[model samples]
Target: MDDKKIEKRIMVPDNLDVQIDDKRITIKGPRGQISKDFSDPRFSKRISIGRSGNEISIVADSNEKKIRSLCGTIAAHARNMIGGATSGYKYKMKVFYTHFPITISVKDKEVQIRNFVGEKGARTARIIGNAEVNVGKDELEIVGVSIEDVGQTAANIEQACKITKRDRRVFQDGVYLTGKYLETGERIKG
Candidate 1:
């Protein structure tokens, strides 16, 4: 007997729209739009992504474990893209210092960390994509339609404040991600 096809589907909400073309998927909603290239050779061979009857689907030609796994991964990415287009993503980070007060600012698509742990000069983290970075006195808010962009931007900020060659117990000065939220104002974690 021939192998049965394996597939995963994501229901498209009425308010949002999805478009697939040439190994790329674009999701658009009221909040914003996000497009991702799913053109990786490994994934392209095992899975095919398309839309049918108000749903997005990833289909695997074979029931092999690897093929099914790849289909699942593609489906998850599509779901995230749709969710992000509709609700977006938010990340909150806090600045903590023991030796010196840290100053943070956003300028020219970059986050500048100044006076961090008594540093002499400013260190900068490049902001990725269209993600917005709002630097408060001791807190930061990163928001964007793409989860990857928002998360990577947050990582950049946190990494910029990383203390090296210092005792972790005493020199515990850094920016930490405290909470995450969806654009609907629902907190994911804290």
Candidate 2:
């Protein structure tokens, strides 16, 4: 017997309360607000904002069903963006200094990883997609509309601390990803 799972897409609002100013839409939410500039007219682009009690809603739209789903996902993401911007999203990373004190810094368009366990030289880490990583003390915040970008960037940061030549059990000193915030899923870490 073939086991198949049926997936269904949820419905989203068609209308939204959009504040237009300087070619950008300021989408206000229950907790906070987010904005995006209107740049594409040729492509199927749509947005809606509405108020319900203390909560404000934002939504995205396209021509196709897949596109609509994507739009709804983006709208939901925008909601989270506003929420995170107001409440803040914090990602915790532990720096294991068993080998050398690892120093991380964001330079130009990439994150530079240096001095891993007193190594002779430092290594470099690449930040994929368009994620904004703000490093504070030992916590790194990966914030963006696309959750995948933030996750990939975080993974890049964590992977940069890996030492291949050393023993896995004894020399486990590296930057580790502790948490991630999802807009539509349960805990993702295993």
Candidate 3:
């Protein structure tokens, strides 16, 4: 019988507060608070999560590759939550067009893209969670406490400007991610 155990621990920063209740984890810091539910019905019986002092632990009874991978994924998620709550995440994007001038605007929870490829109608993308989008003449900035939300928002903008039924090599007009950084101005390598 295989009796090996898999475990991973995440260290919580002093400025951040971590709370674990059942399968839900909540982290609060200077930037903001983020709550995530890690409960999966299929793995609930095989894995357990707990906290001791400033360390969060994820343990699995089975040493199988899949279970071990899941433990590591959970630990990584917790680390991202801690970092996001403390420093926040930022995504920078630039608008590129060869012919028509592209105009972008944020209204409520939607980002409006106008004059794309000279299209009369506008295309819109939905903003996820509490991400804030700043629109400039040729650039956009997305900022949020949750990494998922910020990344998704940037993707939405890029997808909204997707070129269809056009020559791929010639007409290269779209929104592209230029850089990602922490709120404190540290560049994150993609």
**CA deviation > 4 Å runs, candidate 1:** 43-45
TM-score of each: 0.94, 0.53, 0.97
lDDT of 2 by residue, 84-141 (tens): 3344343446566664667778886688777777776666677765567777665666
Q: Which lDDT tens digits does candidate 3 get at residues 1-36?
A: 246988899888888888899878999999999999
lDDT of each: 0.87, 0.56, 0.92
RMSD of candidate 1 to the truth, in angstroms, is 1.7
Higher-ranked by TM-score: 2 or 3: 3
Candidate 1 lDDT score relative to the true structure: 0.87
* Candidate order, TM-score descending: 3, 1, 2
> Cα lDDT of model 2 overall?
0.56
Worst 10 residues of 3 by lDDT: 1-10
Clashes of each: 0, 7, 0
Candidate with the greatest lDDT versus the true structure: 3
Positional deviation of residue 36's Cα in model 1 after best superposition, in angstroms:
0.8
Distance from true location, Cα of 162 in model 3, Å = 0.6
- Candidate order, lDDT descending: 3, 1, 2
